[model samples]
Target: MSSEAPDPLQHIGAALFRPLGVEGVYARTALYEDLVERLTAFISRQRDRSAEILRFPPLMSREQLEKSGYLKSFPNLLGCVCALQGTEAEIRAAAERYEEGADWTRALAPADLVLSPAACYPVYPLVARRGAVPPDGLLFDVAADCFRREPSRSLDRLQSFRMREFVRIGPPEEILAFRQHWMERAQRLAAQLALPCRLDAASDPFFGRVGQVMAVSQLQQSLKFELLIPYYAGAKPTACMSFNYHRDQFGVIWGLKDEAGATAHTGCVAFGMDRLAVALFCVHGLELARWPGSVRAALAL
Candidate 1:
């Protein structure tokens, strides 16, 4: 027998994902989809019943993205929708150029929509439109198919993925308390899945020189945390879950206020559904029958 060890990453790719000829984009296998469904159900059972559940499409208004400051903070990562404009003849000429192996995308113009970068982004605007928040504030369970421009072969770094977020909007104290509660709860959930993980202070992948300052500020203020799980032996751990405290940033931009007329503080606990499934398959064998009984029971798989 060969002395080389089995490549875990290769095994995972073959078992869980079907490549779509793109580096980071993939079509999940049935086994993977089943696992994701079970995981979603398990997570849903843990959510606050009072939270309003909302599902958003992958595309969001470009105007909303600009107002949210994402365009400024992560310009490189944002994916804008574009289309060929002008008369039918112009469009046909543009298409003909592509058939002759010339640049065709140059004729494209920006559309009104852009890919959503996060699940919780649209919630703020919707809530703000409803006027002042109640004294108890608002809790939302939101999910979206999000996209980013960065593409790579790294198993955990997907270009397009699903994000599930539990968002809390209220006073600063309440937001802080909510983050703390989820911080602890996430650890327990990891244990229930029998995955080795750690909670670490983290920062967003902000862009440019000014973003460096913003990242430092975020770390100093303890604004972000991630639940990291090792996916392969030699590689660094992957972040499967993130906890973020947005302070009053979203409130200020969207004009969201609490019953007392103060800008609402916002925080969210986000689960990387694809990354979590990969982690599960990495820790436990790909075979569902081989997984721990407790974990199977927890997910009711």
Candidate 2:
């Protein structure tokens, strides 16, 4: 190996994010945690409307995931929880086989839970259970530890991550308006953070030929927009935030209706917490103390 010292930013990142054996998984440092706290606080302080704040665990019901159509779209990226199901004696036998270098994982069976693909996936079903929403509509600040099956060394894409989402369920006009309003607000937020970003029409990486058509339709309808930020030097930017106009997608799927007896429309603004953190480090340098005063003040870090 060359004797040259490592890139200073890489050195700093290594110190801050202790990567586990798995790529994109890390033990975050205290500074990272502090940054997240400040971001969350900044988001909270900027709210003009009251919202029902909800936090869900990482795991979601498999039935719900199926109902949400995620399996049809991105089946390859779905992570299902599975466990060895058998009598104690059978389980012991499987363990023994594994200890002997055999593929004992075959004994594992699907559990009822799957890792949540997005923070908002569980919210619609829960809201549907409450029956019709008021004419004024429902707004929720929901967050969750989310996961995807992607395995990459890129710091911006994680196998497991956290998402902060603001979801709205209401009439079609109101839902679309809500998304447009947040798109503007997100632009302002990026300016405040002094992070260089651009909004672009985007779509999920849907699987197969049929899924490709779906993705095309989604973009054609301008259903999704993403905020892109540079996450690494000499590399193209990555999406750190997504503003989605689901229209009546989730609302129809969950049979959610408004007080007017019309299908409720849905929209959400989702922030990729880890990706934003990485972008900050990329743009602001390794030392928060040396970052621009305005940026520090904006994040209160």
CA RMSD per model (angstroms): 2.3, 2.3
Off by over 4 Å in 2: 1-9, 232-234
Identify the leading candidate in terms of lDDT: 1
**Candidate 1 lDDT tens digits, 100-201:** 999999999999999999999999999999999888888999999999988998789899999999999988899999999999999999999999999999
Model 1 ranges with Cα > 4 A deviation? 1-7
Candidate no. 1 TM-score: 0.96
TM of each candidate vs. truth: 0.96, 0.95
Q: Give the whole-model CA lDDT for all candidates, comma-separated.
A: 0.94, 0.88
